[model samples]
Target: MTAVGKQIREAILATGPISIAQYMQLSLTSPVGGYYTHGQVFGRTGDFVTSPEISQMFGEIMAIWYILHWEMMGRPTKTRFVELGPGRGTLMDDMLRAAKRFPQFFATIQGVEFVERSPELRRVQMEKLGCPKESMESVKDKNEPDTPGSAVSERYGGISVRWHTQLEEVSVESDCVPMVMAHEFFDALPIYKFEKGTSGWSEVLVDVDDSTTTPAPPQTTSARLAGSPHSSASDNSSECHFKFVRSRSVTSNAAVILRDPRFDSRFDKGDHVEVSAESARVMAVLADWVSQNNGLALIVDYGQDWTQGDTFRGIRKHKFANPLSQPGSMDLTADVDFSYLRLAAQGKAKCFGPVEQGKFLLDMGIQARLKQLLQATTDKKVQQDLVDCYKRLTDPNSMGRIYKVLAVLPNGAQGMPIPFAPPSKEELNRPKVEKIVRK
Candidate 1:
């Protein structure tokens, strides 16, 4: 078992089973032993590959998208370009480089801010993005004031790259357009899973049983002695596991589960539904930010418009694994429901697209970009590699159909942004998926 796994196992044994959200939180962000707290987790060497790492053309196209959107926003003199969870900062690096072609648009931006939680990832981002490392850690939350380590500005190619752990820390001037991007971010937010029962809905929890086998690094064995009451005397073979249990009572919110449009009527007993309160909260906060600042945000991730099933799973070494088996040693993620995201942003901002990523990229001229790169390169192997990457990003069997893009702009903003068309009639008729049934 991993060190973090033992910690989690001990928690469950002592305090009873934990909510899926709590389990995910500790697994991904434990600060001391979280999967993301240390080491490299991106690109070929990482657990999984993101679109930005697939091809430079993806980021370049996004640069064009940003440029067009900035123009649509009247090219505000002072704007902020913020990226959430900027892994290694490759996308931003390509984006800023492409923006150089339009000097006016590039110069109009006053700051390039990154919102990240991992100190290790932030260092990687700084190195890859040509931004200098901060002398101290930034303020931890939005409500907190600048401490000794708060976001001091650093520049790369004349663009200031400010680092913050929370969105609220990135200062926005009055009327300054905040162009925010959250590529492959929402999926990482912890989600709550509820199983439909004959009586009602029950929350899913992680438990320990004989089938559960603790994963290894050798040191994790000591974790059992560190806290769990079921120490060496008990069967050492027991492993972390998953199970479902009913809550004490249906709260006012849980009473509304049947009404949530995210789940279809087809769901019967034992059907599972996952909802991410953290994702919705982030979306609400983002909508509020855009609404207040007259800004825009682009969200891209692998998910469906509406979903009903267990999408939560773990990824280790680019392969799937049982999430409960390897706490704090692998990446845990769930499919994002773009429908809920749109609903969360409603009234405060105009939500657009949740369009297929392949369609969005094609519409944004990825083909032309690919051809341009192909022509520039004379090497056969490089040409074939580029083609393969292009196909991987656009092919229906790959990321094309599974991944989606969403846009949120200030409520009264006129016209559609680039790569997003006016809403289709079918999309117009779809019912909005309201907030999740609070656990």
Candidate 2:
């Protein structure tokens, strides 16, 4: 068994069982062997590839989307772009580079902020975003007196950037507009599984499988984060030795989550309900931020508005793997419950989409951009690669239909963001005119 497995086993034996959320938090962030702490976890060599890594076009379109919203929001001079869990800062880099073409939008950028926790990932982002190593760490910015963690970086074309471990650390400004992006982020938040029983819903917990051989002893594990208890990140064994156990009675989590009046109907059909309290909490906080600061937030991920099936699984090297087999070896994720997200932000913010990615991109003119790129490049390989990436991103059979886009705007908003915006008078009446002519 891996050191992570041994530590988990020891902990479980010491206690009884752990919630799925607890398991995932330990596996992905544990400093001893945490996935994000030790080494690279992106691109061809890493575990998974994200949209920005797939192509520059994804970020360019994102830049366009933000520019439109910036205009809709009255084009504040000091609009800050923030990304949660920015991996290698690829998306931000691509988006910022595209924004440079539009001098107005680029000039409006006061600075960029990344809400990342991993020290290693922070270094990688600093390098990728061209923030020099000598850039002052924990350096106080006179302009932003409230942000003690803020570091003024002379990178990314002179735009001062800062990295914070938590969202609260990045202080908000009353006069500045905040635009936040969370691409494939919420899925990583811990989720609790509940199954309907004869009386009420019971929570699923992870335990040692009696059928599996457990012969290894515990190893010295390290802490991944200050508050997080972690196992060795090097302890991934690629074999799931854990078993799922259900609580005989209703759990406190189930009672509260399954009873949220705003989201009660969401659990009506599902025999199994996967609830992410952390996701909802984060969403609520985000809603409050946007509503107060007149900000906009875009969330892109693979999930449904409401789900009746199990979406919890593990991934290693881009292929599906047993989530319980090897504790820390694989990445654990569940489909985002977008309905839950909407409900969480219900009273505080205006929600748009849960739109299909294909529709969103096409509406944002991805095809036009693709054609432009294709025409500009003569190399057959590069063109083919771009075309493949485009197809993968927008094709219905692939990421198009599966991946979804959700946006959040401050309450009492008049204008809608692009694609999700209401149709113009001409657009609304065009189909009727065409029908009459055909008759």
Once fitted onto the true fold, the runs of candidate 2 whose alpha carbons sit more than 4 angstroms away are 138-155, 213-237, 261-270, 421-439
Per-residue C-alpha lDDT of model 2 across residues 1-439, encoded as one tens digit per residue: 6566777788899998888988888888876676676548876567667788888989999989999888777778889998998988899989988988999888878898899877777777777877665564643557543332444445556787788877777766788888899998998898999876657678899998867553332222111110111222333345557888998788777888778653343343336767898999999998988888888889998877774346677656655556776666766778788978998999999998788888899999999999999999899999999998898788876678868899999998876677886546874564321011111
Residue 261 CA error for candidate 1 (Å)?
7.5
Indicate which candidate wins on TM-score.
Answer: 2
Which residue pairs collide, candidate 1?
Answer: 1-214, 1-215, 212-239
Which has the greatest lDDT?
Answer: 2
**Per-residue accuracy of model 1 over 71-184 as CA lDDT, tens digit each:** 776777877789999988899888877887898987787767888888777767766766444544555565433322323334444556667778887778896788899998
Candidate 2 residue 336 Cα shift, in angstroms, is: 0.4
- lDDT for 176 in candidate 1 is 74
